[model samples]
Target: MNEELNARLLELLARIEPLLPPEQAPIDWSRDVAAIWQRHALGGRLTAVAPRDGVRVEELVGIDHQKQALLDNTRAFLRGRPANHALLWGARGTGKSSLIRALLNDLGDEGLRLIQVDRHDLVGLPTLVQSLRGSDYRFVVYCDDLSFEGSDDAYKALKSVLDGTLTGPPDNVLLYATSNRRHLLPERMADNSDTRIEGGEIHHGDAVEEKISLSDRFGLWLSFYPFDQSTYLAACRHWVAHLGGRFDTDAEAAARRFALERGVRSGRAAWQFAISWVGRQ
Candidate 1:
């Protein structure tokens, strides 16, 4: 009995004082936070890819309706009016990004700053907001080509950034996004299969419908369709004349050649064709 008792006591001591397997030093959360805080401009100091002067809004040329719609929203934002979060959706290369950049130049001097965060960086938005929560200047958090492709988690983070569940979008911040997908998803035909829970009844109070409902978050939805020949030629003529390029490239003839070459027509094509034709200069 004594021997058994002694062995058990030894075992307990060994287990209790096993050197703690070389304890890992506690993580310094404050230091970690400070490090992150330093590297990221939580105060909303913007770092645009191309500085403002390079982006000339007055020179965007054409798409008067599209330009006017966006400029109006931007002006509203500048005035602290009840402005809507905008979603610029449509054909690729149709000045979606250009519009956002142009707005910064047009309004940057009005205490407005455009901070472009890459799509993958959307998850860091909470941290970003927390950092910039107390700033005085207004901000436009621009995301180019934003969409979901098995990236539901990123969307969740963006939902909070767009319209927070608890804090809501910071009064100083507005999100402007450009996407090719109208629904922001691939428009899967299968989504309809589940939106029906009891045969012909739209499924509410469910994840699938909830996900499909994300588009409603944005107040404005603008579409940029491919341009017709006249608009295309006008775009080419505008850019060529403005940039002082070789414009005698037969405006009408060049317009046809641009469409025939690309098999598509849009402001983007017009600009590209103009650049190519100017090589003749």
Candidate 2:
């Protein structure tokens, strides 16, 4: 009877073993320059990905001041000098995310690597950082479209990774995040109701303080704004020419009409127009 029960247990164990998640394969950092953080029941892993192509730093227009500032900081970081984690915040489709991607394409040959992490997957940031601590390549852990609702707690993990914990982020790694929200958190009217003046100084409520603290952790803050008429047309011309389209007088009029229909002129809108105009020709 004991041997019969043992046989049944062995059969069950064999079936369960095949259903378990496999151990993650080690990334070849020497060859791959990018990855995405993927979380699972058994912790998390970095899945290697091919770097995106066709975005060059020179092609980005109208945000030259922001482009140069981030470039200087990144150059300093690659040279092993003191640099701060950067936060790029502002209007949607305003080239905030493009600048980061362009930075990677510009400096990739200089040992700069990128690892993209979703805002929801930030809870595993410490683990991800730990894994990259020993790597020789400098990593930019990018989080795109990062914003949090009032009830979300994942920001706590990101806060700890940024500056809260004693371990802190390693020297070989820096974080670059882009968000449409300047504060990265939703603000409620009630949150401002508790403000008061004391000693001739205004004090923010605890709720406001909590929201500001996260953005404050980033030492470098870059702001992006909506493009004006001349800037928007310039961007359209650049992309249209790059995409093998002629940006003549008629094309300029069409681009303006396109922007009017969309109700906002941005780098993304310009690119979309370029594609449409070029494809139609």
Candidate 3:
């Protein structure tokens, strides 16, 4: 009777085992250059992934100042020098995310590895950073399209990882995030209703301070703007030429029409136009 009860318990355990999150596969830091942070019911784990290919830094056009600033900071970090966490904030479809990918491609040979984490999974950031401590390879903890709604509690986790912690992030790890919102939090007119002046000095209310504090932790801030017509056209021409398509007068006219129809010009738009234009030829 005891043996039969044990057998029944074993059978029930087997039935439920497969529903649990799979064990995280061990990552070979020396072999893999990129990974993604995956959250699960148990906690979170890093999954090795292939780094994106064919995105050269040279191919990124129309944001020279932003590119150079980030590159310099990254280079400093790679050399074990002081470097600040970077926040790339600006217009949609600009080269914010592309620059990070390109940096990985350009510097991966020099012991740079990328670990991408989603904003939703950021609650695990401190644990993740602690695990990567004392590693030989430098890590870029990348969060793409990061932003928080007013009610989101996830930003607290991020803030803790950035500066609120006692020990702070490891020397080998730095966070690089991209967002369309400069502050990474939604702002409303009501939030500013508490603003007041005293002793000829202006003071912000608790709500305003809360929003600004998150972005302030990132020491390096780079802003990207919408590309002008000339810059947009130049990018279109560059991509077309790179893709083995001729950007002649006719192609230029067509590109202009494409941009006009879209109502916004950006590096992404230019790349799309190039793909469509080159595919026909």
The lDDT of each candidate is 0.69, 0.90, 0.92
| Candidate 2: clashing pairs of residues | none
Q: Report how far residue 158 has shifted in candidate 2, in Å.
A: 0.5
Residue pairs in steric clash, candidate 3? none
lDDT for residue 280 in candidate 1, whole number 0-100? 65
Using TM-score, rank the candidates from best to worst. Answer: 3, 2, 1
Candidate number of the best lDDT: 3
| Model 1, residue 122: C-alpha shift (Å) | 0.7
Model 2: residue 224 alpha-carbon error in angstroms:
0.5
Per-residue C-alpha lDDT of model 2 across residues 1-281, encoded as one tens digit per residue: 99999999999999888866677678888888889997665678888888777597878988999999999999999999999999999999999989998987899999999999998898888888988887789999999999999789999888899998898999999999999988899987766666575334356476678888999999999999999999999999999999988999999999999999999999999999999999999
Where does candidate 2 have its weakest 10-residue lDDT segment? 195-204
- Per-residue lDDT, model 2, residue 162, is 95
TM-score of decoy 3 = 0.92
Which lDDT value does model 2 have at 136?
87
Ranking by lDDT: 3, 2, 1
Per-model TM against the reference: 0.76, 0.91, 0.92
| Native-to-model Cα distance after best TM-score fit, residue 169 in candidate 2, in Å | 0.5
The candidate with the higher lDDT, 2 or 3, is 3
